[model samples]
Target: MSTSIRVIEAVKSVNVQGSPAHWANEQGTRFKNPWTSWREHDWRDMYYILFKHNRLTPKAPENMSTLLPTRKPTWNHEGDDAQKLKATWIGHASFFVELPARANTEGRVPKRGARILFDPIFSTHCAPIKLAGTARITPPACALEELPEVDAVVISHNHYDHLDRPTLTKLAALPRKPHFFAPLGNLAQLMSVGVPQDNCHVLDWWQSRRVEVDIPSQDGSDKTVPAVFDLTCTPNQHGEGRTPMDRMGYPKSLWASWVAREVLPDLSSTSPKTVYFAGDTGYRAVLDEQNEDEGPVCEAFKQIGEKFGPIDLALLPIGAYAPRRFMSTVHCSPKDSALVFKDIKAKRAIAMHWGAFILTTEPIMEPPKKLKEACEEVGIEEGAFICTDIGQTMLYD
Candidate 1:
């Protein structure tokens, strides 16, 4: 810890007695939304926007490179202060996170802590047919081949924007393929993308796995030693499906937020540093279930906070929420994101799911701007929640 670095008072997490059973039913045929009875909008709803509220679609920013600035990842892969954790925003809900490494580091190549990737989708377009899909407006942090050895890869859900088959296939083909994790009912999809069944983890909410990876020995020996990390599938308010059949009120597959915790020498103890990813979610039922803007906030985040409070860092969505009456049921507005940061009790947070693809009607730069307003409205400390350049790497102690 650096003397100059200030942090919020640590909030101890209260233990949760049992796994939340509201996530997926025993039959697994359908998933439930415990918070609200959501009414799914059909193509007919689009007519409402077209005929009644025809707002011109926002254009991509001309100075995107400057407005949504970026820099090549600058942290040394191996010698980076192990006590300092690094997060690289890989554009739009995609991030590469390295847990705090063991005190000492040793390697010719960059070797950070157990490296983990979240919702990595590097395609030019986020759709089944690339040519006719939403094109990526900003470039990814780095080329897929340039990423270092990854220990684990977690997908927030099966949305085309979050889960790209080609990208996963390429990663799975790497010599040192990573362990792939997703919410329940996604094992077959991961395998279809070349992830070995032995390396894929499809978990229900609250389920956790202790995965181990090899890191170069601190003794400077060419040999390596094993390090462990815990990957937990936590609850989120979202839905998943790729095709028409996969959708119809109930979720066809589970979607989840993830929590990654570092394992210290004493594996029995809890992690000193934890990271939470709110893949994609709506904080409350609005527009769809409630006509009013204010609604009952989802209890999932509070439960998540109870189990993993005082989170070191959190990546939350602050984009794609436009036509609040329509999109508020699925995506989070910047204000909603601010509440999520509070609900999770994160020490620090970075804004994502914006400045990349134009998934909705908001202006390209609107999310970050709105987030600033939201944070101020909520009296969050300045710099506590920030937006980094698309490819920038932020370090925290």
Candidate 2:
């Protein structure tokens, strides 16, 4: 196998070592709370400080996934064509996006448009425990064979749930290997899966790439669809790894959100439509920061908005946050999602990260329930925030 590598931006390179690190060691274990020395008022004091105004009512009960009506997985290539955007949720963070094909003259249904998948995790399990722990409550909406032809795959980080080696290996075997885009230090993992070195694009925090797309037009001729998609390595506060022995923690692989923009053929407008894939993130006051002091996270989001202002659609995570003491620092709660919505100023937002995988002790249904209440509290209109179950598809005009 040829071992050629291509460097795209300032992102650092990483080793593909397979040794396990100190993941759950008792002495350095970070799961246990530090309340052993706290007093009575200390508890209330902290509570009021954190959740002073927006108090969460009715603590989530155990077994949350069962609360919501279950929905079966469905897959199809059917869709209406009108230069619109369509998204099919494939459980967890995976999605099938059908971008508009050039106006077909025959009026036949739009043929295959660019099919882009986000954080495509096709593994049977997305947790460290495998058969022992964090088993997936629901299988991936569509198996790899059930998937439509893929043009590109975007991976956010190297977490087990985000980047599954077995899944990627299967995808690499497809007739046409899809283009893989990931943050720094992740190319090694993709190489191990047999993804062609040239097919991989390693990006930094503010870098982008322009891809040429062929959109079949209705006039019997092919239209040169030049979609300038800029895939920057936006910042996220999280860690990565699959096992205790191989804990490739945060800053090692560079967790990030992806911004894909479609610049019109005319040079007058740089980017007409922008879609943000807000990968896993925890709530931080800087998320609401109006200034740059919010650090890498705020700067990255702002840069995306400036380059491609007014995001058309945002796929944001709104689940797996429980035992707030630990998750709050890394994951965003429903209320925090509201804040992110306002911060990014997205036109519409779809919620994910819940009801699919058992990543946390929080009830599976709690995220959406809490999200609904949070939207209500902030007076967000209905349909502004969509929390659909697996196998649901959304159309954006």
Candidate 3:
């Protein structure tokens, strides 16, 4: 089938309706955050957070420059023979993940397992204009040129920090041209940067698309089997805007968390390895007035856990949540991130979206510390919630 036909079929398989325009219609919007009501931050609140909040300024460590370059860990493209799951934190919200391909017995140089990249931002600054905006306090864990060939690239939103233009341009130029999956209405942005239309796939909340990959057998057998990777765009409590002037177009595009699973044809009956990537979120209405867990956001997570748990791993944001009064609607504090970790019932989770940029007033190192405290109070094990160094790659079984 043609690429356009395949996309249409994919949308139909998800049972989504309405035009792309209708997806963002305020009058009949389908997206809703049931737990917390969204209130826009006015100029006064912005001013207060920007100027009045003395604590918001990031205090770089005395040894920051010396320590930034020392965190590098050797990247292992090949995963452990037993677990077959490897993930490298490429700093901030970006990750390079490899899921084991089908066990190959005939050995055709077992094709490198499925390589997936999430929210890749390799530029010095995460903004529309390269010369201005939030500069990276720490360098990228891995350079874009050093990245292994990718099979797929997943973008959560149009925010400059998450969906950077320079990064996309580089990816578009790659010889392999990995498939790009983004939320509804983001295809325009991708195409604007020269990504081919056929290479982009758009998804609405709760919608799923399946991609097929081939891997050589492990035993030197020439035989191969197709591994199916399913990508689903799930709900998140956040807004989308690449710039302040584009606030009106927020709903026109969608923001989301994602869930990915690897299913081998031979092992179809068995459980698959599942990973949850929480692009960005806030935990406002998750708990109600009575402190009961009845909000839509909470319910959505419960539903996610019910349908996709127990998740093997989750990459959750744990920073940029200072001045709660102003950021409560858009960002999740470390405590909030811990709550989400529990809400989704993940087997393991790694903290992300912090340490590389001073997007808010909180100290750069505060997130991991707060996350550990919250996890302890809630009875989560110590190593269960991990904070890896910028260039560290952890093997997850």
Q: How does residue 116 of candidate 2 score in lDDT? A: 74
Separately for all candidates shown, the number of backbone clashes (residues 3 or more apart, or on different chains) is 2, 8, 13
* Model 1 TM-score, 2 decimals: 0.88
Q: Over the stretch 46-136, how does candidate 2's per-residue lDDT look in tens digits?
A: 5654574223322333554456433544333444544576677777777766564433233433354566789888776776456634456
- Cα lDDT tens digits, model 1, 90-147, are 9889999987766433322214577889999889899887663278878998888888
Off by over 4 Å in 3: 1-37, 42-44, 49-55, 65-70, 77-79, 104-109, 130-133, 216-224, 266-270, 285-298
TM-score of 3: 0.85
What count of clashes does model 1 give?
2
Candidate 3 residue lDDT tens string, 1-397: 1011122225323333233322445543333344334455678686886677655466667776565442564554544543466788888899888776545333233455677899999989887665523778788886799886777899998888899899999999986688899988788899988889888988877788887665555555655545567888887777777666766533667788899887555634546789999997776632213342343333456657777888999999999887666666678887777878888889999888987777878777788889989899888888998888887777765
lDDT of each: 0.78, 0.62, 0.73
| Deviation of model 3 at 231, angstroms | 0.2
TM-score of each: 0.88, 0.74, 0.85
Lowest lDDT sum, 10 consecutive residues, model 1, at 1-10
Badly placed stretches (over 4 Å) of model 1 are 1-25, 37-39, 42-46, 49-55, 75-80, 104-111, 267-271, 288-293
